[model samples]
Target: MIIGVPKEIKDNEARVGVTPAGVRALTEAGHKVLVETHAGELSGFTDDDYQNAGAEIVGDRGYVWGKSETVVKVKEPIEPEYAYFREGLVLFTYLHLAPIPDLTNKLLEAKVTGIAYETVRDRQGTLPLLTPMSEVAGRMSVQVGAAYLEKEHGGRGILLGGVPGVPPAHVTIIGGGIVGTNAAKIALGFGAKVTLVDLNLNRLRELDDLYQGRLYTLASNSYNLANATREADLVIGAVLIPGATAPKLVTRTMVSQMKKGSVIVDVAIDQGGCVETAKPTSHSNPSYVVDGVVHYCVTNMPGAVPHTSTLALTNSTFPYLMRIANLGAREALKKDPGLAEGLNTYQGKVTYRGVAESQQREWTPAADLIS
Candidate 1:
């Protein structure tokens, strides 16, 4: 099998699909790896590193896309790269297709076999591939939120961890998953008052144990969510619904009633955001004032810290990549039920129920095709 790693072209997205160490693994397994020139440069992996790992460095993205049987990526393919899509090509990446109708249609039209890293499940039903980046994004959400809370950044002029005479800022996180947990960890580390809400009572109890009662864990309901957001100095929208679009937990009206100059870091922005006002912002311009509240909705927050993100993401994703490469996607999917869940599209049909229902498209079960 020939695998291609293209440099991520999304705005400020510096993570590559595979590191040199990953390439070495594939190469050692008798697979040929082609890396786009400098694809891993921003991630601290040099082209020479790839060469030493037995990967051939291609000069351009087009060559890498055209030559490889399987094309791996950090982010979904943007519009310009859409033209490179070919029939029977295997695309393995974080394809958040539920919110991107165009990308979904393009993959179907091109008959590409699309595998989404975000949808891949582990034996325990956890999203293993998406977990690392989610952790990074979740942790970064607080860091960015605290920065944007300063008066210079048009925030409420409150410090996350206040001085001796002042009260600390209040942070409300809207989920109890990986993102919410990490956000709370960082927010509490800054001495900010933290409130985490989730629908699962057991999960909330687990979080209580994790935090040792340091943060408030509320049952997720309309009233609790609204009241929390209304009183929050910084609201982190961390809700997720797997491959589906994130549920909009914070309404525009709720946002408008929040404290003036408050900040919202919507970590769920990649899945179309849990805040009604969030529109994807780029790293070049990461935030905007919405109804007197600042919104940090950068779709690729992990991309800003490519070195850590690339390593963390590749570490979790490499085993699956090795499986698919060594056994071929078809056999690999048939052999592993969890990996089969990653199949968003196979041939011209949508194979993942979440993406299909979210997009209002018909889907074929992965089992049917794999069998």
Candidate 2:
């Protein structure tokens, strides 16, 4: 099997699909790996590093995409890369197709076998591939929100951890999943008063035990969300519904009622955001004002820390990549039920039920294809 690793071309995206270590692992397993020139440069890995790991360096993006049987990437393929898709090519990446109708259409039209990392599940029904990056994004959400809270950034001039005489800022996280948990951890580390809201009572109780009453955990009803937003100095929208679009927990009206210049870091922006007013921004211009509140909704927050993000992401994805490379997609997916859940689109059909329902498209079970 020939695997390709292309440099991520999304707005301000610096992470690569694989690291030198990953390439070496693939090569040792008798798979040929092709890496785009300088693909890992942003992640602090050089072309020489990939070469030493037994990967051939391709000069252009087209070569890697065209020649490889499976193309692994950090982000979804942008418009320019759409032309490279072929009938049998496998695209393994974070395809948040629920929100991107155009990309979804392209994958179907081109008959590409699309495997989304974000939808891939583990034996315990947890998102293994998405967890590492989500952890990074969740932690960074607080760090970025804190910076944007300064007066110069048009935020409510307040310190996350206040001085001796002042009260700490109120930080509200709208989910208690991996992203929200990491955000709460960082916020509490800063001595900020934190509140985490979620729909699962058992998970909430678990968090209660984990945090030991350091933060408030509330039910995820509309009234609770709105009230929490109003009291929040910084709101972290960390809600997620797997491969589906994130539910709008914080409405525009609720946002308007929040303190002026308050910051919202929507970690769920990749899944179309849980805040009604949230729109994806780039790291270069990460925040915008919406109804007197600041929104920091960068879709690729982990890209801001490419070195850590790339390594962490590859660590989880490499094992699955090797499985597909060694056994082939059909045999590998059929053998592993969890990996089959990752199949969003295969052979011109939507295989993931959540994505099919979200996109309003015809659906087919992955077993239909593999069988």
Number of backbone collisions per candidate: 0, 0
**Residue pairs of candidate 1 with colliding backbone atoms:** none
lDDT of each: 0.94, 0.94
Off by over 4 Å in 1: none
Q: Per-residue CA lDDT of candidate 1, range 256-336, in tens?
A: 999999999999988899999999999999989989999999999999999999999999999999998999989899999
Query: Where is model 1 poorest over a 10-residue stretch in terms of lDDT?
Result: 217-226
Write one digit per residue (lDDT tens) for candidate 2, span 1-371: 99999988889899999999998989999999999998999999999999999999999889999999999999989999999999999999999998998999999999999999998999999999999998999999999999989999999899999989999999999999999999999999999999999999999999999989998999989999889999999999998899998988899999999999899999999989999999989988988998899999999999999999999999999999999999998888999998999999988899988888887888899988887
What's every prediction's RMSD, in angstroms? 0.8, 0.8
Question: Which lDDT value does model 2 have at 231?
Answer: 98
